[model samples]
Target: MTRRWTDAALTAVAPTTWGTTYLVTAELLPADRPLWSGAIRALPAGLLLLALTRRRPHGVWWGRAALLGALNIGAFFPLLFVAAYRLPGGTAAVLGAAQPLLVAVLTVALLRDRPGRPALLAALAAPAGVALVVLRPGAGLDPLGVAAGLAGTAAMAAGLVLTRRWGRPPGVGTLAATSWQLVAGGLLIVPVAAAVEGAPPAPDGPALLGYAWLGLAGTALAYALWFRGAARLPVTRVSVLGALSPLTAATLGWLVLGQALSPTQLTGFAVAVAAMVFGQLPDRAARGRRADQPARGQRVGRPAPGRQVEQQAHGRHVGQPARRRLVGQPARGRLVGQPVRRRLVGQPARSRRQASAGASAATPSGSAPGGSSAAAASGSVNRCAADGAAA
Candidate 1:
């Protein structure tokens, strides 16, 4: 349990650090260079990781690496920056809060993993809480920014699901795999950045420091932890942890930027935090139900041995007691559709002898009819019973 929580905490650090991106971009990074921002953030960290790990993708992993990188990093970063720039921080964060829901949907569609009820509700509640915290009554809605935020959220969701689906290759560590994706995504962004922006901006001391912080702590360390958690945990659980991003951003705003939090905002903060905590809990109901269920091929409510036989023989209802067999009847092997023939118990041998003699006298000996033969057979059976009794 401790280990699992530790893993979750580490995974959570990724989004928590990512929450600083909006502040860093606003304060230290250059204006009107979203593409350059994305390229610079991704490439250096990826290269550094590649240098440290000294591993490369082999076989189909190359394509998988590129695809994952494109969705997670290449496409996600620039679009995220665009949204951040175009909309209010609260509005951007609110849009990003939809990530959990997106990831949940993709998980069901791609990985075929269904989330529990608590998780689904948390996914919904987290965004609503974020909205209360960040969204103002008259917040401007830029169509381009809204589209960008939604698109970025979707790209990240797909990337997260795919990460869980494919996992890392045999013998590849999280750092190595993370490095591969970073490099692939960074490479994808470079040409696009160059084509769109024409020239990259030169960084001053603060900008460089900001870039270093982003590349090392935000991108490299964050993504490594995120992928590590995704590989280890359920995708739904991992995705919901992203609620920390906006929460962390709000916290930083309050602490660093001296922003005031209203009572409503505090309530929202409480709600979002509750949702995140709730989302982490194990699905105890599902587990309990599974535990209570019987294993495969196991019978339930089986009848007792004698009762089972009686049911088969007489077509009796289940749970009914077995009926006692009649006197002089065979213990087993009663043929189907045969009539039951029984005799009275405790009858005297003298009576049986008298009955046999009478039966023989009634039958005609010279020309035997069906009735005479039947009477003779009955007398023979009675005589055998009398002889046994006398002996």
Candidate 2:
């Protein structure tokens, strides 16, 4: 497939799979041992992909891959499950809504790109939507649960940014980068999950199915697609599309788990989505700008006059004078008719004096006998010519 379609498919697949997490968590999975489930979901599956691919990372890629793994998967996935287990499903999803806005803000710092005018407003505005969705009087949602959700969202957002900034090392594909994170996260969580939750009573058929799907499809396939997109597109744009994750989860909650969406919740979803769209638009505009930029070595092979003429042609506005002033010309071209006037005004007084002297030399000298005036005019013309030449 073309990279664009591949990238879109990958990005869409992750959120689609993730949307099922809430329903799976509530209906099929064990309640108290969330981290263990997360660990199992990540580590073994990641290693299996690595083994199947027959790939190994090299040199600094090992350390960089480890860091990438920690940021994107290891830190994010388990913390995400912990938050979901602790918080109400809808409230947790609302915290996930903050991902796009957080990514847009972080991209400005991490990638050094302006989030643009609309993005600036959306960055401030989207959090209000998240607040409306999560903060309620009788929901029984604790501050700690909300905080954990926010922390996980932030970690994921930062991970996405870093993934884009420092992509996988040469000779390694998306699977390798993803595997490192999966293994690292899974390994980190194993002892913790074991120490805290111990071994659970054997899961029933549906629960076992849930764990299998979460491990293989959710952790492995979803990340594979996510890394594909991260490798190809801006992190902010990727995060904007990821807003679908919460919506998907909400819809799945309604269909599978019987969670009803209130009008306020719907409004929050709509507003947050609009802000994400707003954040993404600037990146599309920037992509166009980069496309318009002169390609490498395009100017080098052209002749000097041709290059200058091309630059002038590129720089000039339509309906302007053909003989535009050169770069050093005073009164730079800005307003209409100004450059022509500036050119005329800037013609040195010495030029006119030289013209007058030349005129005298061209005509007969009426005032001097034996053409003394001719000699005098010749001297003046010479002097003027000399001065013009010197000046």
Candidate 3:
């Protein structure tokens, strides 16, 4: 338990910082220049990472890195900006909250990965939790914003699955891989930002600070932690942690803006946090494996060293439970319905009484355990003994 939490600590950094993205966008960044903000956030950070690492994508990795970056950053950044700007923060948040579900579904469809019930339920439950935290009676959702939000969610989900599937190449570190994606994503962002918004005024002090923080902490550091987590942990587990982002956004809104959190908001906050924590738990299959393994001090089977020797000594494997043996009975391992009509060694094997009794005990029709050799072996011995006594 401690170990899982400790390992997830870096992954936790990404979403926790991301929670502030909404806050920074709303409070600090200039209006009508979200694309500019995204570009500034990603490009420089990516370049800095590239400069620091001095590594480049090799061979087919160039294409793979581009695709990943486009999904996670290029398309995702612009769409996310639209969602943040056009929709009520909570409405956008609810849309963002659906990311885990998309990731879980895509993993199942593409990777053939099955998420445990807890992770699935937590993912399904997150939107409701976010709605609770941020939704108000007057919170109106915009169609364009909703579409953008969904698209961004999908883009990020696809990127996450790919990150887990095609991990960092040999000799390339996690930071280097992160830099590759960022550089590609940032480059993609460049033309789009210019074409759509043309060029925005030079960023003022607050906007500049926001851009610096986003580039340094949010984009570079956050993605480094994200790919690191995805590389090591199950994709579903890492995705579930994203619930923290909306929760963080809501808490920041309440505190930073001095807006009071209502009773319902508080309840929603607790639920969201609880769901994220619960979703990180090991799946049922993992838990079952751990449970089935015997304690180190106890012996459930033969020693690992002696298992092969034991198998060699006996024609049968030692691990398999031995079948019960009937005394003085033929060791043929099949169920006998009745005495054979043919003679054995030119003499009848059993008397008429034995055939009649054998037929009475078991019918010709038989299955595995229900009508198997077990019943025939014991029944035959008892009937033969009874006949001998009667004689």
Candidate 4:
């Protein structure tokens, strides 16, 4: 499939799966076992995917993959769970909405992408929408949970940038990367889960279903889709769409858990979706251009006319310095245009000797006869001497 279609599909799918996170958390999972449940969601499914794909990531990809695993899964998963556990659900959800703003800042600092005025404005709207939909009075807004949620969002943003910057190397499919991350994250969290909630009681039937969905669909499939979407779309816009996840979570809370979505919250969701659509549009000028534009064509990608001329002038300046350096030293190339006067122009023999002595004093290097002899006679021997010194 074309990258555009695939990216759109993946973006649509990823956030939808993510919307299920709250449902799985509040409805199905055992209370006070968020850490263990999160670990299970990551590790087994990751290993299973790895086994199915049977592909190994190579080179810097190994380290990059592991780092991504740590950021997107290992660190993020537990932190998210903690935010949900420690804070009011609405509070955690609102803070999570700040991802697009984080992505824009990171893209500028890390990716060197200039997210121009429109993208910046659009990115701003997404987080505002998130705040509108999720923040509420009396929500457990602790310092740690808020920090964890924001940091988790930042980690996910960084992971997206890293993934996009280092695209999947040849022969490494999406599933392999997803699987390895899951397994890596799972392993990293195992000890923490074991230590904190050793041998936790088994979840009931609905909880098991929720766990399975969170594990198989939310972590594995959602991440696979997220990475795939991120590879093709701008990272900032992808994070903007991520605003939908929390809003969807709230809507599901209303429908499935008898929670309420106010008119203001619904408006926030619409604004965020609008911002995402606006931010993701490609630059028209950047497209429809060839990488290597041919000469004598109106090549859109070619250097500007003024720049081309300036570059040529600069090239001549460089070449002129080299020719001057060769003048008082040695000439490897043919010196075909020397006039008789050039050899002894405007100076008596004694004065030339004094000049040569002065140059030799300034240079203090071995004198050679051939290429640079003319420069010495022209009373500009220092030009060649300077070039020699520079060399």
Deviation in Å, model 2, residue 363 alpha carbon: 44
Listed in order, each prediction's TM-score against the native is: 0.75, 0.69, 0.75, 0.71
Better of 3 and 4 by lDDT: 3
Candidate 3, 169-255: lDDT as tens digits:
899998899998898999999888899899855888998899989999999999999998998888887888887888888888878
- Which portions of model 4 miss their true places by more than 4 Å? 1-6, 284-391
Give the C-alpha lDDT of model 4: 0.72
After the best TM-score superposition of candidate 4, give how far the Cα of residue 186 lies from its true spot, in angstroms: 1.0
Cα lDDT listed for each candidate? 0.82, 0.68, 0.79, 0.72
Query: Of the candidates shown, which would achieve the greatest lDDT relative to the real structure?
Result: 1
Which stretches of candidate 3 lie above 4 Å from their native place? 286-391
TM-score of 2: 0.69
Off by over 4 Å in 1: 293-391
lDDT of 1 at 144: 98
Worst 10 residues of 1 by lDDT: 382-391
Q: Model 3 compared with the native: what TM-score?
A: 0.75
- Residue-level error in angstroms, candidate 4, position 346: 54
Residue 179, model 1: Cα distance from true site in angstroms: 0.5
lDDT of 4 by residue, 148-246 (tens): 888888888888888788878887788898887888778888888889889855778988788789888887788888887887788876777787788
Position 271, candidate 2: lDDT: 80
